[model samples]
Target: MFSFEDYREILRLVKESGRYATYGEALEREEFIIMRHDVEYSVDRAYALSRVEDSMDFRSNYFFQWTNNSYNILSRKNRDLLTDMHERGHMIGLHFALNGMTDMELIRRRIRQEMDMLSDMLGFAVNTFSIHRPSPAVLAENIKLPGILNAYQDEFFSFDPKAGPDSALRVKYLSDANHIWRYGYPDAETIAAHPRIQILAHPFAWTKKGYENEENYRTLIREKYAEMIDSIDGECKDFSPYREGFMGMLT
Candidate 1:
């Protein structure tokens, strides 16, 4: 949750469990633990984690937001990183934003549209998506597209508002949302117990030093400043002349 080594430890634990599987691979297996990373803040951070997994010969799903204000997924630098991840056998999926609308049909339509657009942009079919930060209503809806895999679907995500406590899980779900282990940290024993598991980890919260939440945001803000400076320099010729003044403080 904090350090890259910490993340690697979890990856190692999952791999050694002999139950690890990708989402697509899960389609054929009953005992599978699918590792998912939602690119919440930085694709760079996501790519770093991807590299960590790659070093261990592990592949996981990485979902990126097309509409995120923090990072531009369509940017050339990001596209290159994404392509590299895909080339290395990592799955790139869409991190969808509902934008406040909860209509099931409309959500379905928009997901397809975004996936198709992202797929076209990346030159690879994005066959899956994970909701950015879902509302309870969205979870209850349990949306599923014809050919696309919804990360929140009943198969992977078990949720039923009306069913209340009676609703049982088909696949155990765990998340490092808000930089905390929401559904009991996926420890060694937990991983061994659950046959079908889906883990959602955000790459942005982790760093080499394992900074605290406040420290993490400060780091992200500094990164954002560098990104904005580059963005302006790229978009406007005049900005380049004065770009050095701000860029100098990045370190």
Candidate 2:
């Protein structure tokens, strides 16, 4: 039942604790919570989640994948959504997809190309990135690119209990992957126990009404198809001659 209400409750707990901070702000603080969203499915969902966060005066980082064809980041509709999120005080970052790429030099090249393109499209400089479906080798390397903060890097986050004992700063990370909270939902009890925490939620996993993972994808596809049809209808209206022909073809 991870609906919008559930999301609101999570924010309420974070606000009550007064430990929530954006990724950039968290870097400066000794102990803080980093609320992040990876936009893998729909920008519309991201916008909806951003509105929820706005109501609670909470700011988080949204990392978007340029490689994902499900949503066009450069499209006017999505660009507007991103702009709205930015205006609402949420930071935007790159969700870089290695796609099992093993070459270090090639990885760096692709990262720069995508980051620059995305930054230009958003009219903002993206300084942070999170690897999308990173492989074991990529995670082990922990390569840090210039001018960008690596979310997966050891310096920023760690899940090792042994590392926690050795290092002064400890990072507790949790994520909602495949519509399931693998590490369990971050309730008040969980938040209180961890001094430094990172909660990664995917916007697509949440909805105004609770939906299963498959239902979320179906809804998005339906909406996208309807949007395309509407655009075509609008264009046909301008060209009266084509309107009749297009309508006939449908019939």
Candidate 3:
């Protein structure tokens, strides 16, 4: 139910408190709030939020999933959007899922392989990464990549399942997962309480209009549905003339 305006307020709070850095810049810092977004459902939504950040002259890390079923990173539309975001000075990186693999060596290879592929597609070096919904085994591995900065690395994050918003840990972690604040919402007080924090806000949960929770998801579904129809129109000449009518249905 968060509006882009609400998101903007959070951004302003962090920026004013301001020891925040992009993953690349934070590598040199002792304490920072790593402003990050893992694009989950919609690149279009990510683009919307990125514009908000851009308007504020703010920059942060954005991670895109390589194997995401929701959107194709290789598609021309997505490639252009992602590359455009990078050109605007926002850090782009891989949002990876270990997929339950436990062998540390094998995990390293998998990460690098995808990293290389993602880098090639973006036409830039993607040296930072964040894991998507890491399981206990994935966290236990503490998977490391050479010459790369992992957002979940022990130096930046400490995983404690029972940890709460007020719990004092090595590093504070706040997330906007499942469209709900999993830790504590970073109000002025909540944010000031943590010296070192990592904020994982998903672009999927936000919008320009910022509808109520149920309507927000319904809107996303319609957007995805239209994207599917557009793809169908591209590959199926028979659907070409029908595209507008199908699109109108959603409208």
Q: Which candidate wins on TM-score?
A: 3
Rank by lDDT, highest first.
Answer: 1, 3, 2
For residues 31-144, what per-residue lDDT tens digits would candidate 3 score against the true structure? 788888998878998888899999888988889897877887778998999889989988898998767776878878888999998888778999988888887667767767
- Pairs of colliding residues, candidate 3: none
Runs in model 2 with CA error above 4 Å?
A: 159-169, 234-251
The list of candidate 1 runs beyond 4 A from truth reads 162-168, 233-244, 248-251
Give the Cα lDDT of each candidate.
0.86, 0.79, 0.84
Report lDDT (Cα) of residue 154, candidate 2. 72
Clashing pairs in 2: none
Candidate 2 structure, TM-score to reference: 0.85
Lowest-scoring 10 consecutive residues by lDDT in candidate 2? 159-168
For all predictions, the C-alpha RMSD in Å is 2.5, 4.5, 1.7
lDDT, candidate 2, 37-156, per-residue tens = 888868888888999888887888999988886778888878888888888788999999887789988987888888888888899888888889877677777777777777877755
lDDT winner among the candidates? 1
| Count of backbone collisions in candidate 1 | 0
> Model 2, clash count?
0
Instruction: Give lDDT: candidate 3, residue 251.
Output: 78
